[model samples]
Target: MDALDASVPAISPSRPFRASVVTFRALVGSGFRRYATYRQATVAGTFTNIVFGFLRCYVLLAVAAGTAGAMAGGYDARQLATFVWVGQGLLNVVGIWGWADLSERIRTGDIVADLVRPVSPVTAYLAADLGRGAHALLTRVAPPVLVGALFFPMATPSRWQTVPLFAASVLLAVVGSFGCRYLVNATAYWLADARGPLAFWTLGSGVLAGLYFPLRLLPDWLAVTLWVATPLPGLLQTPLDVLIERDPPALQAGLVALQAVWAVIMLALAGWVQRRAERKLVVQGG
Candidate 1:
């Protein structure tokens, strides 16, 4: 028998590309279009975000009020309101939960096709996530923020620079969040079902990421540890704090830098794990 063509890379039994900018953009556009097609879901989700925004706002304000309107957890009433509403908006932007498509594909053995594709799964999925984030920014984010701004004393960024800084942080959060979800879904390779990990991630991510409250409210040692050891704060707290100008310029810059670092690290880890999973497929004749 002819030796397997030396030029062709060996196909791993169970597997899974760097997509270029043009390809990446197309992937993103496709993702955006897919989510956009769900008009009713978009509306329902937006309404839900708005409702939660109000609920969280009132609870946080009450906390501030009980402290005689003094700054609690470094947040005055106005800043606290901004945190709640903006955080509600960011829920869709970062998409802290609700990703299971990859796991389903793996369980169905459909991911083998993905392995044959030219595009890297990481880049493709991330591009699509970017597109999804773009859609959320336009539809889900603006509404709740506008509603809160209209009715509440929300804090505005003290410096114009904070606006752009916050935007950068938000973008990094999206990338980092995708990396996290990708890893969680990859568990399907070994577990046959990713539900357990997905459920646990959903519950823990919200609190750890500061969706329900500010990280600063936690004890100093705990908050600092979370900030340094995990990407959770970058998912919401960093961006919102930057938006409200809660930190000095230097610290704000440091926060965004930290987010960038986490984004890179998480993506790299995902890529490495994907490669190892592919190797397992080869060894198992998957």
Candidate 2:
């Protein structure tokens, strides 16, 4: 062998910097393109969301109208309508369900290939999810809002700060949702079949994350408890609340801060869990 070949060192798959930012960006772009290829599914899902948005908006409107001029769950009719429609948009943006990629790979033992790749699984998956979120933001978020605006009175943010704040909250929601799904898929490391956990996650995330209804509609204590204890509200409630200016300036900023904190925490936890899982798999000759 030549001196150049002799001097070159082998690269390990898990080298800390194996996956660079460019690689992540490419992964995200590819992920976006992958979903874009599913044109029919996107069209169908968007239609379903709009249909559900109408049903949910009507229900919330009825609840608000029945309040006899009192703010039901701190929302008037217009705000409630905004909540329903924005939530329909966010439902796809946050991607509360239909994420079985990692678990499916694990079930088929293809996770071994992923584990050996020169990339962090958590980050690679996260980049792809962000891509998916971007696609959803384009294809799914706007149609419902536009359609609802035509049919119903929609609430607008009071302060200009709320616009940027809502955007940040939405981005963090995507991150936090990815973390939650990552941890859920990571369970495949332990369980032979991850479908059960994925099912459980799908069922609970919608209600707990306030996709079904505004968290404020629940009793004060329950709402506060969930907010303090779980990242669920940060996934959907925070962004919607910010968009409608449900809280004062200080509280709105605080809510976004909390979402950021949770996103970091959950992502860190996912990375740690994945590392441990990889080590365990290696020891078992996986």
Candidate 3:
């Protein structure tokens, strides 16, 4: 009996991972609930995006109208209108700005509590952010799209595969965007105040991710370079382009594939940075 008791494993090898997944899922739910509390903010944000959608759509439509082929940046009038509406809808979902949670915690010295939690801070925050993004899709993304469809000729998906592909792209975009924001927020781990890096990330992500206009308007080489070299384009531009069918079905798949790769890379980078910060904190605490 004593030998049998000694030989038995207290916890299986997969137990920790399983437990982590459970915790992550629960945290995701918690995140959803947390964001759901911001009812007023959600409505205001959706309204703001709708307002901007109109302004941007009008300007882009005018540009396309004046161009030689009734196209600007390879987008026809309807396509450009769709782009504007979708971009506006995604503005909150993809979280281009207004994320400073980590920085605020670090500044307040409250982040130490996160370290003591069972789940890794990265996983916990990411799960929560996924929930927040999910909430945004419902509360923020839909309204502007409905409003746009009522007012403008939004382009329909050209291919059956486009719907699924765009859905995948948006998921990847949300994850990749969270990773980017996570890293930007993690800067507070070292800097104590992450304003400079956060500001730069905020501004650059908006412009480079095709928030103001489609990236295809740039020179082909520059557009390709940005798409291949930076995660920023994958965060917003790839998803938007995929939705609007800027390229053929094969090319659209390729773009979403690229987004998956960046999503992996960004998450890996965030994890690495988190580990480094944890080790440093331990050393300091010791």
Which lDDT values do the candidates have, in the order given? 0.87, 0.88, 0.87
lDDT of 3 by residue, 1-286 (tens): 4585453335455788776666677777778889899899888888888989999999998889899999999999888988999889888888879899988887777888888887788888989998888888888888999999999988998688988888899899999998999999988889878999999998899899999888999999999999999998998889888888888888889989999999999999999999998777532231
How does model 2 score by TM-score? 0.91
Ranking by lDDT: 2, 1, 3
TM-score of 3: 0.92
Tens-digit lDDT string for candidate 2 (6-113): 523454558746536557777787788889999999999989999999998888888888887847799988888899998998998899898989878877788877
Q: Which ten residues in a row have the lowest lDDT in candidate 2?
A: 4-13
RMSD of 3: 6.1
Instruction: Flag regions of model 1 displaced more than 4 Å.
Output: 1-19, 282-286
How far residue 199's Cα lies from its native spot in candidate 3, in Å, is 1.4
Cα-based TM-score, every candidate: 0.91, 0.91, 0.92
lDDT score for residue 282 of model 1: 33
- As for candidate 1, its clashing pairs are 13-286, 16-115, 17-119, 17-120
Off-target runs (Cα >4 Å) in candidate 2 are: 1-19, 282-286
In model 2, state the lDDT of residue 136: 92
